[model samples]
Target chain A: MADLILLFFLLVCAVTAVAQRELLNSAIILSIYSLIMAVVWVRLGAVDVAITEASVGAGISTVLFIAVLTRVKRREEITRFRVQVLPLIVVLAVGAALIYGTLDMPDFGSAAAVSNTHVVPRYLEKGVEETGTDNYVAAILASYRGYDTLGETTVIFTAGLCVVLLIRSEKKRRL
Target chain B: MMDFILAKYNFWIYVIIMMIGFYAVIAKSNLIKKIIGLNIFQTSVFLLFISIGKVEGGTVPIYQGVEAVYINPLPHVLILTAIVVGVSITAVAFALVVNIYREYGTIEENAILEMSKTDD
Candidate 1:
């Protein structure tokens, strides 16, 4: 019951943030959105995901957003906040397609879910034995999925390197 | 009818939130606003994946050497990487936005368009 109400409030915060007049205000609301989203993940039995969301979504992202917001103009243009119809229609169509597609999916928390049946049991049974880690998610991430995590780390490194390059170039030009 | 709504309402709510983000990304004029929309859209997908990973009487996927159901661990691992990637992408995006503002002097879509037209 509480989870349902939280989801509803999440939707409201998300929409309100989108409609905010100031980019800074939107960023703040989005930070709140991320925080609530973390709680939602906890309710869904994903503690690791909840931690990641709280740190990445609510903490670091908000700081980065505000730092950038300070560098740019604070307020969004009011003259251009017009109701756009064609995009709304397009978004609605895509959403309808998604909803129709979900009718066939397994119900939430079904033990017989296909995802729960295959490959999952193997990981569950052998995960600790293979990786010497109690947390299967961590074991998979660090051992079974080592290459994927490395690639993601490299991607983050590349992104940071690119940002540094861009900022340095801008500064040199200014100098 | 109530049971149907209860059973399927999560999917519908996520879709609606996803659409709101989509609409903002397409319709908003401000670059920063678009970034926020992109974040919302990205996280909605995350929530959808998390919802799928739930189990009827499951605990978190920390093995305890005892009998218990555990939620799927794959999605959680995948989403952790994705969240990091999303942040890096946002960082690069904001850097680009800053450079765009320096080059063009405005982040509003229409203003940037007009500036480029004047440049041409």
Candidate 2:
């Protein structure tokens, strides 16, 4: 019942955020959407992901969006709200195809689902013994998948470098 | 019919959200709106993966006495990294958008395109 309500709000937020004409309002709505998403993650049994979503999705992303909005126009140019037939058709077609694809997915939250039967068992069974961490998500992230995390860090570093290179004022260079 | 809907509603909702994002990306003229759409699209995919890892009756993937049924930890770990990466990508995208505004004096796609065409 709670999941149902949260999911419904999720849909509402997604639609409302997209429909907003003001970029700042849209960004704020997106932040609220992220907060709802974090709660949904908690209900889905992912505490670590919920925390990250709360911080990064709702917090940092919103801040960055607003910062950019300050430097650019906040109001999207007023255009006639005519139905964009081509994009609408394309979106509908893709959505229908994806819905058809989900027909074969295991019933939601089923323990016997394929995702649970794979290497998950080993992870759940031996994770603590092997990694000496109470949090299996942390253990897997830091120990089993440390290299991936390192790569992800490098990606973030490259992004920061790109931002500095792209936006820093030329006056700063001379100074 | 009810069983079908009950079993698959989450997936359906995700598809709807994904389509909403897709629509914004392709239809919206503002570059920032397109980036917002991209964020929504990325987050929906993350939701799908996290949903796949859920167990009907399970606790968070942390050690809690040997008897606890923990949901899959792998997906959480993967998504943890992904969320950070997604934010980084958003930052880069915003930087590009800021640069575009700097050069063209407008962020709307149509305006920028028209300006560029007149430049040529």
Candidate 3:
């Protein structure tokens, strides 16, 4: 039941991505899409992932996109020039192969999944004891993957600097 | 029959909400309206998360020396941080929007494109 709803939502987001006309509009939709993906992550028992998605994906990225949009507002009218059937066929073939590789996988919610058998159980048990934090997700994100988070933060800072460089001019516009 | 009905109907309803948010984003040219759609989409995801975190008969996590079950606190804490992030992003986006309006004199994307083309 829930799976069907999630699948349907995914389809909707895809449609929204393609159908939007304005660049700014599309960017906004993209933010929304990111937000929805966060929820999906949480529903799938990936609360930590959801937090990152909501913050970085939906929040920070959206701001970056809008900043870029401010500089270049209008999208170049997309014209489908050539029939690129060969590329499409190749892409589809690769996608199908990937899907086929997962044929022997356990059911989605099965306890035997790698996520459960692997690091998750250990984290669930030892996370609080080791980190001494009530929120294990935060501990994992800030401690276990501290280097990755630092890298991500640096990337965000770089993006912000780039935006400032691009928009800044000899005669600064009054904000 | 109950499970069948739940599966058949509830799934589509969530889909429709998501699509509406997505469609609004894709269809509208107005920057603000698109943000609104984004909010809708973001909120829907929040709903999904909250729903998933919900355990039947679960009480609030706060304990007053009572032995009642509680819905997981993990999702709530995560959401609190997420909401702050969402607001910050919105603030930055709006700031840019203001800057765009200042420089371009118009927020409409098509018009700006046309203006840039002629200037070029």
Candidate 4:
């Protein structure tokens, strides 16, 4: 029941956020959207995801969006006479296709679901045995899937370097 | 009837949220707005994945007494990596947007296209 309300509120925030004309307002609304999403993740028993979402989705991304706003124009220009029908059609088609795809998915929370049966039990059974970590999620992430995590960390490193290079180029151009 | 709706309502709501972000990404003109739209879209995808991981009576994946059902922690780990990636990418994107503004003097998509056309 509570989850239902949170989902509805998320939908509302998502709509209001996208519909806002002012870029600052849109960014602010998106922050709220992330916060609510974090709560919903907690409600779903995903405590780690909730914490990460709260910090990253609400914390880092909002600041980045707002900081860039200072460099760019505050208000979005409302151009006229542009035919935007193509994007609308494309969005509608994609949404419909996604809805169609969801129809065959297993009912939520069924223990017999494919996602539950495939390799999950082994993780639950031998996860701590193999990795020696107390937390199953931690065991899988840092050990079973450590290589992927390494690549992800590298991606973050690359992005940071890229941002620094961009700033440096701007300074050189000014000189 | 109500049973079916109650079971899958979360998925349906997230689909709506996803579409809202999708529309903003496709239809919005401001570069900042487009980035914001992408943020919305990414978080919604996170919600969808986490929701799928829920077990009705599951607890957190952290060690508890044996024989307790913990929600699928796989999705949480994957999405954690994804959330970090999303944040870093957003930073890079913003840096790029700042550069674009400096070069073209406008952040609107149409205006940038016009500037490029004249330069070509």
TM-score against native, each model: 0.97, 0.97, 0.53, 0.96
Q: Write the per-residue lDDT of candidate 1 for residues A1-175, one digit (tens) a residue.
A: 9999899889989999999987888998999999999999999888999999999899999999999988888888866556988998899899999999989988878879897898888999999888888999999899988999999999999999999999998999898
Better of 1 and 4 by lDDT: 1
Better of 1 and 2 by TM-score: 1
| lDDT of every predicted structure (CA atoms) | 0.90, 0.92, 0.55, 0.85
State how far residue B61 of model 4 sits from its true place (Å): 0.9
Error (Å) of candidate 2 at residue B58 is: 0.9
Best by lDDT: 2
Q: Flag clash pairs in model 4.
A: none
Query: What TM-score would you report for chain A in candidate 4?
Result: 0.94
Give the candidate order by descending DockQ. Answer: 2, 1, 4, 3
Residue A68, candidate 2: C-alpha displacement in angstroms: 0.7
**Predicted complex 4: CAPRI docking category:** high
Candidate 4 off by > 4 Å: A81-83
Candidate 1 segments exceeding 4 Å error: none
DockQ, all candidates in order: 0.85, 0.89, 0.08, 0.80
lDDT of 3 at A99: 43
User: What interface RMSD does each of the candidate structures achieve?
Assistant: 0.9, 0.9, 8.6, 1.1
Worst 10 residues of 1 chain B by lDDT: B1-10
Poorest 10 consecutive residues by lDDT, candidate 2 chain A: A166-175
Worst 10 residues of 3 chain B by lDDT: B6-15
lDDT of 2: 0.92
Clashing pairs in 3: A20-B26
B59-119: candidate 1 lDDT, tens digit per residue:
9999977577899998898899999999999999999999998898888988999888998
Write the residue-wise lDDT of candidate 3 on A1-175 in tens digits.
5756665665566455545556776667677777777767656555655676777778776776676565654453434544345544553464456345434434333345343356544555666678877565566566665665566566556546644653474137443
